[model samples]
Target: MSDTFDAYDDDGNRYAVPVRRSYINTSDLSGPGRIEGLPSFHLSGGGAVNRIDDQTFEIVATGKRLTVRA
Candidate 1:
């Protein structure tokens, strides 16, 4: 699994923010594995998750501080 981040309005309205994307290997999501190559935004604090489309998704991580845009 991977993660990504986007800015949203206070009313939960998504805006045009730079879409940050990261890639995590399959092994990373299997069991208890470590995820590498994360961005600084994810490293700050709480992460986020969003549904991009029917088959696509965005996972933000608070653990390693990274967002995987899948």
Candidate 2:
């Protein structure tokens, strides 16, 4: 089974998780792009989420690292 998690910033802002699309799963060309109710690691603006440990993550963008709670 797959586990779902929510990611939150230090200030308690919730990020909308995105459903990843790949070449093998391209049949649904016009479906909802985000996974609701889950926290997003991929920032909507820019940046990538890095796993620090269980329940903790780091947002890296523009040479800055911000803490994220997961």
Candidate 3:
């Protein structure tokens, strides 16, 4: 995340700007998983909710990030 402002658009008409952009950190999870009984798991790739024993697992992520191994 990095940005600077001065592209003009208040009456100064320069509007061809692109700032504040920096993202490249993809590897949210790796192979090995058994979040049974809700030990510890909170995926941020957009979907992962598991609670074993009472049984409830809702894992959804097509935006990329899926690794589960038991």
Candidate 4:
């Protein structure tokens, strides 16, 4: 099966997205002095999944950070 799942935005918008696992790659970055190769989900509707921590994930769409549902 694929890593696609349902995620919700801050406005309670549901989206079917695909999860991208983290690895030792140089393609993912958050900032100039930060690393962002964590496990994230790609939303088909818009934006991306930003990993806040081990047990927390957020949706970043259109420059907005949204909460995810468990």
Maximum-lDDT candidate? 4
Q: Is candidate 2 or candidate 3 better by lDDT?
A: 2
| lDDT of model number 1 | 0.39
Off by over 4 Å in 3: 13-18, 22-24, 28-70
Error of 3 at 40 (Å): 32
Better of 2 and 3 by TM-score: 2
Best by TM-score: 4
The digit string of per-residue lDDT tens for model 1 on 1-70 reads 4333444433454432233556565454456544555433322234444545433334454221222234
TM-score of each: 0.19, 0.41, 0.19, 0.44
Worst 10 residues of 4 by lDDT: 25-34
The lDDT for every candidate, in the order shown, is: 0.39, 0.50, 0.31, 0.60
Q: Quick one: RMSD of model 1?
A: 10.8
Any runs in candidate 4 off by more than 4 Å, and if so which? 21-40, 45-47, 54-61
Q: Name the candidate, 1 or 3, with the larger TM-score value.
A: 3
Give per-residue CA lDDT, model 3, range 1-70, as digits (tens).
3332223323343322122333444444684443223133334332343323232223333222222222
Any idea what lDDT model 3 has? 0.31
Local accuracy of candidate 4 as per-residue lDDT tens digits, 1-70? 2376665666777667777765554454663343446466667655666766543456665555545466
**Model 3 clashing residue pairs (backbone):** none
- Which is the winner by lDDT between candidate 1 and candidate 4? 4
